[model samples]
Target: MTQTSATPLPPPEERRRLREAASLTQAQVAAQVGASRETVRAWENGRTTPRGHRKEAYAQLLSSLAAQTAAQEAVGEAEVTWRQQSTRPLTPAQAFDALYAFCAPALVRQTYLLTGRRELARESVERAFQFAWQRWPEVARDRDPAGWVRATAYDFALSPWHRFRPRYRHPEPPPADASDRALLDVLLKLPPPQRRALLLYDGVGLDLPETAAESEASTPATARRLLHARAAVADRLPALSDPTELHRRLAELASAERLRAAKPPTVRDSSERRARFWTRAAIAFTVTLIGTTALTLRTAPTRYEPPVPPGQTVLGVPPKVAPGPLSEREVELRRKLREETASGPVRLVPETR
Candidate 1:
């Protein structure tokens, strides 16, 4: 039997150059990944990279499509096959940038709707980006990074601890006045399980199966949760007005989100910018001191002292009380004893007087 030698494949960089030279647009490339055009452009331009699950997916699509096209050509099809390879293999940075771009708009809008402040939305999304960056390696591998980030942001925003201890505070109303109200009303009408399913499905645009995974329920249960939530909103919509108005309002909210998307803040990494070292140290020291004091109090022993006696007379002696008299029958018995001694059997025997 004769063994066949497999030819080595070209690197992703060479493939990207070849694709670009072919005059195909980034959007056309991204259509293969089911991603937006911006994502493709960013990947090709070195602004980002495909990663993890996306990398495997991209590779599969590229290879499979290439094979199919080659087979078709052998059969006499004149259509040219487009190369669908990623510009680079998966990396954490590329994955972070991709997920950040994907989630930024939706997250920012949600922040605005909740707080009515674009600045707050910017801050929230920026922090969310930082968090996503920290977990980029894992998230990039996830099938739906966008939905994952949304759920995380929602959890962050709704944290009870945040109500009292916030990194920074901003008081603002939600955008799209009537729309906000209607959305809130609809949300309020939903039970917790149903609300979670509905938001993950409709608001974040996840399918029932994905929503089911997020909500920790079976597929049928998740479907039921969404149905119940929709029913609840539907029952209330008649009293509120046309349901289409709610959707229009939501679109208005989404549009408003675009206006509020600000460039994320950047911190310069320079040695000359050395600042806040002493202030940070002082804060740490203060917190440490407080914690130490609390620990000491918790571990300290308890001591109690006996009460002192009255000052004047004695240390341990108690006060005495007067004695009371016996009954009259004791006096009668004494008198009878004296008479018996005097009588002495009625005889004065040995009475010398």
Candidate 2:
């Protein structure tokens, strides 16, 4: 007689474990199984199971995922131990190095999750780090510098200018398992605000308040968004029904995403670009001043004496003229006066003689 193996776990438990191991969301498995995500959830919750051929196919998929996850986990455990040992405290410069090493990859992964574009995600993270490096003192003093950078990266990824540029797509690394891809697909379907809330709370491990602050939403609003997101996720991946497991899996997926690519180099210091900007601004101001002055001088009126009228003189001198002859009345009156004077003077002259 042939030896037989023990029966496998119940479908619900098996489904949950396999989904976690594969890092797939229920939505992903549902797509593969040609069933609704709710149906998959029901199967995992022991509310129902696939009948006949579907059940057999689902089991096979779960078994395959289990085998793959086991092998990957063995390697992951070793790597994680090494990473944990390597992370330690250091001096300021070394601390920045440590921070970059610790945070940049994760930031990039977070950006990628938000934008779904690899190159844009990388650029966003690099730009955020560049800003961080430029303002190291302030960032270092903050309680959550990494969160600050992550927030910056998120904003950068969502910039509208991205729509105008030709998309230069960098192929993403294949998902560690179907579950990861599925979850990411679902996340990508979410509105940016909801996606950000979920990532901050679940993926980045922020509390509700912090997540709300990051998403620029009120606490109640953020909570509502998270509630909706969680329900959606649970519908797809029944394994994530457990809040603890949901957080754990989200954190694991975030870590795996970080490992997908190397931490992009800390962006080159922007000091040179800043210096150039100031230099250009100064030159522009000086040029503007000089140009305005020259324009004023060129356009200004010149001062000089105005021309005088033809007969006018600065000294008030009159023009020379000839005198007219005496009138007839004046001549007649002078003759009469002469006669009278002659008559009267006759006696006086005789006496005088």
Candidate 3:
């Protein structure tokens, strides 16, 4: 009966947060709840909720873990809890801000390496965060929100559209250090996919499978990219042959420059404003289209009317004759008459005078 009792679960996002805070994997939680990993994933993604006894088990597990996290935080002990705020219930805004603060700076730096431009790097990360804010519920419940944002940032930073923009047509200035410059040039030289794979694998310390997943490439393809990228770098800069050294150099290269990300509040505000603008624009367009359609239907001709043919002149109609030179006979006659009929003409001339 107790197992059958009604036990309301936390919101999907919070449930995920609680699980993540406890450092338990989705498979682990699913095992406890007697469900598959995908089922738990669906539950956390808000696609589906557990039923009957499973619901209570899932709820109780999250509640207990949350309590344990709170207790751990209460005492003065530095441990791997939520990276920013304590696991106590967090407002969405608070959680979002905490996540941004923890992840944005480092992500910006990583993005800067991915694209050799400070401005593009900063913009990419901010844009990615903006997207995350728009889909906060989905992103918050995601197993790795930071990775989600990172993937988004990579997509934006590596987009071919940027190349067409006048502002981003040319590459930004390279780093001052010779090694950093060479490394960046080499990175820029790599294909976008390869570049992304290398950054995820070597620079961000993601394992091969994780890197492949993030890159959206097959495992074999990702491995080839990583190998080719590493070979390219090793060829150009023998000093960075080691993967650990490459990571260190990448970090140093990114940190040596000043790449600042916008604050979370600003990013959120911008995203909200942009979303509202697009929504209003869409509404306006729909109204305009509907009105135009209505007007067209009301005023449009109901029946077909053939167009009148262009005017054509009648073939039988005569054109007026224009005077031309007189005939030779008539000219001779006129000259003879003028000479023979001089008496009447002379009288007339005297009367006129």
Candidate 4:
């Protein structure tokens, strides 16, 4: 007797949860895997089973989305826990305190890696948190608040606004060892996307697909970037030849960044600062309003001259004139036309007797 084995399938709930966690719709997953929406829904609902290539594609896509979802969920849980710690009304100050204490260091480190400027990194992280404080209610409800802040901080660090800001004379200290410096040089030389992919994948401990998502690129594109980054690094740094050594080096770099991030400048109480900011803003607004009002009054037309007393016209006003007769030249032209019409050649009519 011949026996056939059946492939085990993931649970429907698991499939649905992974899709939702990745913030993807059934249609999106179907498009990615070249399957129909109904087919994907059927698979997720356990109404049907994927076969051969479809099964493999489903498994791969599901696994990748699952990893990304897991990373985001981990951050989400941290945010939720932080929020749950206090039962009292959450104020901006209180919210900032919680987020800063929990997420600031990590964000700073991430920015530092991105920009390679310590002061810029610090400023970027602080500004991002400040924005978070301003929008605490919305941010607090975010699925991954820490990730949101990190992304904000990264964008701020790379913003062109920094060009106008005062430059720091002193640079951040370099890596202690030659190998570290070489590694940094190699990383810095890579294109932004590739570098970000490398850092997120190797340094931040995110999986390949998660790194792709974070970099805002497709998995295949991210994989290509990672390959290019690794090839460049391998060419420059012989020590990174071994996979174990490469991981160790990346871990060391991550550790160093964390250490640097830990000692950020003390954040002042935002309550007083916020109060002062609003007070200044209000005063400026009031002054501007007064100035605008005064200017309008000065520039406004004099009050309506009491409508010119009924019949009596104003001194400078001109009287209305009715249309006059045609000019002399026009009259002469009209007379000539009448004469020409009366003097026109005449034909005699012959009458039969």
- Candidate 4 local lDDT, 193-311, one digit each (tens): 78778777777777987777667799999999988888898999876866667777877765575444332224534434775899899999999999999999999989777665558
Q: Give candidate 1 regions above 4 Å deviation.
A: 1-85, 111-121, 165-171, 174-180, 188-193, 217-221, 239-249, 257-259, 262-353
- lDDT, residue 79, candidate 1: 32
TM-score of 1: 0.45
lDDT of 3 by residue, 1-353 (tens): 66535656889999888888889999999999899999999999999988878888888888798889889777535554444446578888988999999999999999988888889989999999999999999999999999999999999998888888899987677777887788899999999888999999889999999999998889999999999999999999998999989999988888898878898999999999989999999999999999999999999999999999999978987899998899999999888778766565565443533
Q: Where's the lowest-lDDT run of ten residues in candidate 4?
A: 1-10
lDDT for model 1 comes to 0.60
Worst 10 residues of 2 by lDDT: 1-10
Q: Candidate 2 residues 213-288, lDDT tens each?
A: 8778899999999888888888888888777898787666666654343443425445346657878999999999
Whole-model lDDT for model 4 versus the true structure? Answer: 0.75
lDDT of 1 by residue, 1-353 (tens): 01111222236564466455545666776776777887766665667767655555555655655665567566543332222234446566555656566668667876554444466556666665656665566767778777676666655554445546454364544444665566665664566677667656665567888888866689999998877777786676654234345445545655654544444333111111223565678899999999999999898877766689777965788768676675688778777767777675556334666
- Candidate 1 vs 4: which has more lDDT: 4
- The per-model lDDT (C-alpha) reads 0.60, 0.76, 0.89, 0.75
**Who wins the lDDT comparison?**
3
- Best-first order by lDDT: 3, 2, 4, 1
Q: How do all models score by TM-score?
A: 0.45, 0.51, 0.63, 0.52
Backbone collision count in every prediction?
A: 1, 6, 0, 0
In the order shown, the candidates' Cα RMSDs to the true structure are 18.6, 21.9, 17.4, 24.8
